[model samples]
Target: MTFPELVVFDLDFTLWDCGGTWCDCLRPPFLKKEGQFFDSDGRHLTLYSDVLAILDDVDDLGLPMALASRTERPDWARELLKLFGIQDRFPYQEIYPGSKVKHLKKISDLSRVPLDKMLFFDDEHRNLADLRPYGVRCQHVASGMSEELFSEGLELFA
Candidate 1:
């Protein structure tokens, strides 16, 4: 039943899917329609089906959650997080364009938690690759975030 001190997730295709693509690809002026999120072009934005529950489960575990996204549009990402009503979930967010290694390093410094005690999930292999050398437990998210995938990540961390 061991758990990492912190859990970090990548945005884009990991925590959410922005119309089957990255959020940076979507046009601006994001909107909400009947509780669903969309862009000006009608591209839908949504947290992966299991995202909310997974976040809550992690919170229940008393582990702090953070977001690391190398998206070019940090403002849009933040807006979407607010639109989804999850802007408050992550106390640490590094959404600018850069290596994830830098993001995790900053999170480590901010939380005073070493890299080894953090578990990171990202859809892109290269992103995971960048953090692997720093002793961060990395999970490759194959099809967005799912309960099964999250469970496997916890097992790997343990």
Candidate 2:
């Protein structure tokens, strides 16, 4: 298999833990320090342990990355990304409240990468199912993006 032209990610559970709640939507902006984010309510939001390593590996492969998040609080998501200093990692982002299909379509159209040539990672099973018809090689990120899953994705698209 050839490597995908683009890789897309889901923001919330796939990247970071939002305390299993929408507390990420709270009023105050997140605090960034020591490589972690603390929400307004002092709830901790952290990237999966393997996130940086995986991202670095993907970047080393010269693959472009994008974000497709159906997060209700788009502002919060953006803020978190910025605080994490990963905002520039994904040049194409769609973080509105909508179906994953719509997000993937927009990313595909914007990046000019065919659905089949794109690899997507999301935490929701429904999202994986929804993207199948679009020909997107979707992977379910159960706990978060892990090295094993990342390798599987690489193999699938390699």
* Full-model lDDT for every candidate: 0.92, 0.84
lDDT tens per residue, model 2, 25-49: 6656677668667877778888888
**Candidate 2: where is the Cα deviation over 4 Å?**
22-27, 33-35
Off by over 4 Å in 1: none
Question: Residue-wise lDDT of candidate 1 within 1-158, one digit each (tens)?
Answer: 78899999999989888998888899989888898889999998988899999999999999999999999999989988988889999989988999999999999999999999999999999998888998999999999999999999999766
User: What lDDT does model 1 reach?
Assistant: 0.92
lDDT of residue 101 for candidate 1? 92
- In model 2, what lDDT does residue 6 have? 91
Candidate 1 TM-score over all chains jointly: 0.97
- In angstroms, give how far residue 72 of model 1 lies from its true place: 0.4
